[model samples]
Target chain A: MSAAAARADAGTAVARVRGLRKSYGDREVVAGVDLELFAGECFGLLGPNGAGKTTTLKLCLGLVEPDGGSIDLFGYDLPRQAREARQRVGVVPQVDSLDPDFTVSENLLVFGRYFGLSDAQVKARIPDLLEFANLSGRGDAKIQALSGGMKRRLTLARALVNDPDLVILDEPTTGLDPQARHVIWDRLKQLTAQGKTLLLTTHFMEEAERLCTRLSVLDQGRVIATGEPRALIAEHIEPQVVEVYGDGVDEWASAHAAPLSERCERTGETVFCYAHDAGPLVASLAAWPGLRHLHRPANLEDLFLKLTGREMRD
Target chain B: MAADAQSRRTVARASPWRLPAFSLRALHVWRRNFLVWRKLAIPSMLGNFADPAFYMLALGYGLGGLLPAVDGLPYIAFLAAGTICYSTMNTATFEALYSAFSRMHVQRTWDAILNAPLSLDDIVTGEALWAATKSLFSGVAILVVVWLLGLADSWRVLWLVPLALLVGLCFASLGLIVTALAPSYDFFMYYFTLVVTPMMLVCGVFFPVAQLPDWLQSVSSVLPLTHAVAIARPLLAGEVPGQVLLHVAVLAGYGLVAFHIALVLARRRLLR
Candidate 1:
C-alpha cells in the first residue's frame, strides 16, 4: 500500500466492473463480482481453486460475455466496445499462448500485427522488448526450444508489443521455479515503476502482498474481503504469530490456553498462537521446556487462511 | 447502463447471424496463417498437388483405357475437370478442419489472437479465407498440370481461377462449420465420411450426375460441388457453361450461408 499509495490527485479509474455475473449450465462460477482498478496501481484477485478468478479475468478482457453486469473499461462498454477498450490493454492468459510454430521474435512481430502495428514498428521494438524479458540474443530461437521460464518471459514481452496502458495477467507465476518467479516479479515491478496499471490474480499470498497495492480475496465467486494488503492482515489477524511444536505441545496449549494467547489453532503437530505482541507469547514459552517455539510478525498468508477456510478443496 | 447491457446480451443470445462486416483487420489473421505456412510451404504445397495428380492420372489413363470416351471427351480430360473441383474442395476442407483446428484448440493461437484488439468475427473470417487461399494454390497447381497434359488450351480456362476460389470458399466454409462443432481431431472422420466423401462421389467428380440415381441426382443438384463441376466440365471442354449465374449463385450461396453458420457456432464454442 505504501509503495504505490494513491496520490491526492488519483481520481480516474482505469477499469470499473460492477455486479458481474456469469454461469455455466447450472453451475454459477462468478456469482456477483465487482472490481475497480485505478491508474498506476497493482490490484490482485486472490482465490482458491474454483473461486472464479480466471472467469473474472476473462470477463475483464472481454474474452467472455458476462451473464449480467456492467463493465466500463477505459470509459467504454465491454464485450461490444471491447475492441476499442482492448486496443490499449495487454493480456497474459492463464495458459501460455506463445506460438510454438514461430520463433521468439516472430511471435512478437505477428502479435503486433493483430493490433494494427506494422512489421517495421514491431521489428524496431523487438530488440528492446526481448532485452526486457532477459532474452537478449535468442530472437531467432524456436518457441519449442525455450524453457518454461523463457516462454513466460516471452509471453510478457509479447503482451508489451502494443505498449498497452493496462496489463492483465492471470496467475503469471503459477508454475515457475523460485528463480523464474523472482525474474517475473522484477519485470512486473519495472512495469509498475513505469506507471503501468496491473490487475492480476494469484493464490500465492506473498506475491499478492509484494506486488498488489490492493487486493480482493474471492471465495465461491464472491469477494470476501477487499482492502490494502497489510491493512487487511492487521484487521483480520493478530500482529504476531508464535508456533509451538514438540512432544507435549498439545498438553502445554491446554494448560496455558486462557491466560497466554488471544487465540490458538492446532493443525497436525503445530499449535499456532495468535497475539497482539510477541513479548508475552515468547516469555510464556519458557514454562514448557520440552516445547520448541518460534515467534514472527503476521503475514498476508495468515489473513488469507483466516478468511478462507483451511480445509483442502479436493 | 444496466438496461443497455441487458438489451445487448439479449440481442446476442437471440440472433448471431449478422452480415459479414468484412473487417479489414481479418487480414492480420490471414497474415498469421501465411507466416506460419511460409515455413512449410514447399513440402505442404507439393503434398496438396501430388495427391490429386496421382488420382487423376491413374484413374484417367488406367481406368479410361478400359472404358469408352466419356461424353465424347477422353476420360483423362473429363476426369481432369472434375479433379480440379474435387482437389480444390479437398484442399480447402482439409486446411479448414485440421490445420485451423490445431491453431484454435491445440496450439491456442486463436486464443492468443483473441487477446488482441480484433474480434472473434475477424478470426473466423480470416481462418476461412486462409483455407480458401490454400485451395486456390492447390487449384492453380492442378490447372497448370492440366494445361501441360493437353486437356484444353483455350482462354476459357482463365475463368476457372475465380471458380476455384468459389469452390474453395464453399467447402472451406462448410469445413469450418464442422471445425467449430468438433471436439477433437477424431471428430473430422465423421465429416469426411458423412459429408465430404459422399459429396465427392455423387457431385459428378468421377462420372456425370445423370448417371446418379434419380433421388441422388436431385440431391447432387443442390450440392455446391455439382455446380463447381458443372461449370468446370464445360470450361475444360472450351464451351460456355450453361446457367452460369445459377451455378455461381449456388456455390456463392453455400459459401455465404455456411460462413455465417460457422461464425455463429464458433462464437458459441470459443466465446463461452
Candidate 2:
C-alpha cells in the first residue's frame, strides 16, 4: 500500500482548516480552502505560479490572517494560539532566508532559539542535523560561501533544529539541479520515515509523485482535485499518451488524432494523444512515418494538466 | 445584527491603535542581531567613529576657533553635547531603518522568525531595543571622547547614558514606523531628506537652537532631538537641566507612541 493510503485514513488530523478565505485587495488569493493534514504523511500542494499555493501555506501557518474561515493546528486555534501551535511546527519558506552573517551551524543555532530551545540543547542537535543534511564538517562555513544546494540542505537542517512534528516546505527544490533535487528528495523521504508530517508546495509533478503520497492541485485560488498520486492519475487521465512532434506533426495530428486516440491536445509543435489502450494508438502512429512519437504510461503531469488546464499560468 | 457584527469585525481588523503584547521571546531576536554584529564589531565601531571624529575636528575646533563662545561655553564644548544626541539619533535611525528593513524585507528573516513561535510584536520590540542599545553605545562613546578631551569633568555627565538611551529609543521607534511603510530602500531617501535632515538642522546638532529664528526655535522645541539636546547639554555642563521631567516626558512619549504606531503599521504590512 502507498504511504498516503496507509497513513491518511487511519491517521489523526494534526491540522484542520475549513472554508479558509483570504484576499489581497480585490484579488482573492485563497478562496475557501479546506484541508486536513494527517499525521505522518507528506501532503503536497501542487499549483502553477500565483495559484494561491504560497498564500495558502502562509495562511496555514497564521503568518497571513484569513479573511474568513477557521484554522486548527495541532488542536490550537490559529492567528491567536498560532504561537503555541508553531512551537510544535517548523517551516522552510519558498525562498531561503538564511542569515548571511552567521556560519552554517550558527544559522541553525540561532533559529532554534526562537522555539525556546536552550543553547546547549540546540548545540547538541546541530552536529546531527548537519550530518543529516550531509554538511557535517562545514558547520563553520558562511552562508555566502556555500553553494545553492548546500544552502538549501542547511535550510532543511535548520527547519529540523527543534525536532518539530510538522514541517512545511514551500517549493523546497524549485531551482535545484537534478542531483541536488535527488539529495533533497532523499532527505524528505527520510523525514517521512521519521514520522514527521510534512506539508509542501511544488510546481514539479515528478517531485509530487516521488515525495508525496497524496496531494491537492490548486488553480485560481481553489483546489481542483485531491487524491493519491497514482489514484489521481488513474481517475483523471487516460492510461497512456502518445506525443507526436517535429516537422509535419500538425498535419499528422489532423489526419490521425481524432480517429486513433481517446482524446487529443495541441501545444506548440507537438500533439498529445491520450488513449485507454496504447496498442491501437502505437499502431496508428506508425502510419505517420515522418513524425517522431513517444509512447508512455500517463503520470501525475497528465493528471495535473487535465485538471488545471494547459494554459500557461504566471 | 449580522451586518453590524460584520462591520465591527472589519473595524477590529483595521484598528489604528493597539496595545502590543510583548514577550521574553523578543530577547532571542536581540541575540540574533547581537551575534551577527559581534563578528563585524571592530569595523562597525570604526565606521561609527569616523563620521563624528571628522565633525568634531572640522566643525567643533576649526569653526570654534573663528567664533566666540556661545551660551557661556566654548564652541567645542557646546558642540560636544549636541554631537552625542545627534550621533545617537543617526545610529538609531540607520539601524532601525536599513538593518531592520534588510532583516524584515530583503533577507526575509522576519518571515522566517514569524513562522516560528515568535510573534511580530516580539520581533519589532527586539529590533527597537537592539537599535536603542547600539545608539546608546554610540552616544556613550562620544561622551567618553568628550571626557578625555577635558570638555566636561562633572559626575552629572553620567546622565548621558540614560539620556542617550532615551534619544535612541525615540528615534528608533520613529525610524521603524517609516520602515513599516517603506516599499524599498529608495523610500528611505524621502524620509532622510524630509524628516531626519530637517530635524538635525533645526534641533541644534551643529549650533544652538536659539541661533535660529524665533519661528524655527518653536519648530525645534517639538522635535525629539531638540528635547534630547536640551537635557544633555545642561547635564554635560555639571548643571541639572531645568524641566527635566518635561524633557524626559517628551522623549518617552515619542518613543512609546511611535512604537505603538509601528506595531500597527507592521501588522497591516506583514499580516495581510
Model 1 / residue B269 / CA error / Å:
1.1
- On a 0 to 100 scale, what is the lDDT of residue A134 in model 2? 94
The reply for model 2, stretches above 4 Å from the true place, is A1-10, B1-16
Q: Model 2, DockQ value?
A: 0.49
Among all candidates shown, the one with the greatest DockQ? 2
* Candidate 1 wrongly placed segments (more than 4 Å): A1-10, A245-249, A257-259, A279-293, B1-20
Worst 10 residues of 2 chain B by lDDT: B2-11
- For every model in order, the TM-score on chain A comes to 0.94, 0.96
- Candidate 2 docks at the CAPRI level of medium
- TM-score of each model's chain B: 0.94, 0.93
**Taking the tens digit of each residue's C-alpha lDDT, what string does model 2 give over B1-272?**
22233312421242435689999999999999999889988887766656786797688889999989888899898899988998899999999999999999999999889988999999999999999998988888888889989987999999899998889999999999999999999999999999999998899778888889999999889999999999999988999999999989999999999999999999889887
**For model 1, how does the per-residue alpha-carbon lDDT over B28-141 read when each residue is reduced to its tens digit?**
999989998899999889778898999999999999999898888899999999999999999999999999999999999999999999888999999988999999999989
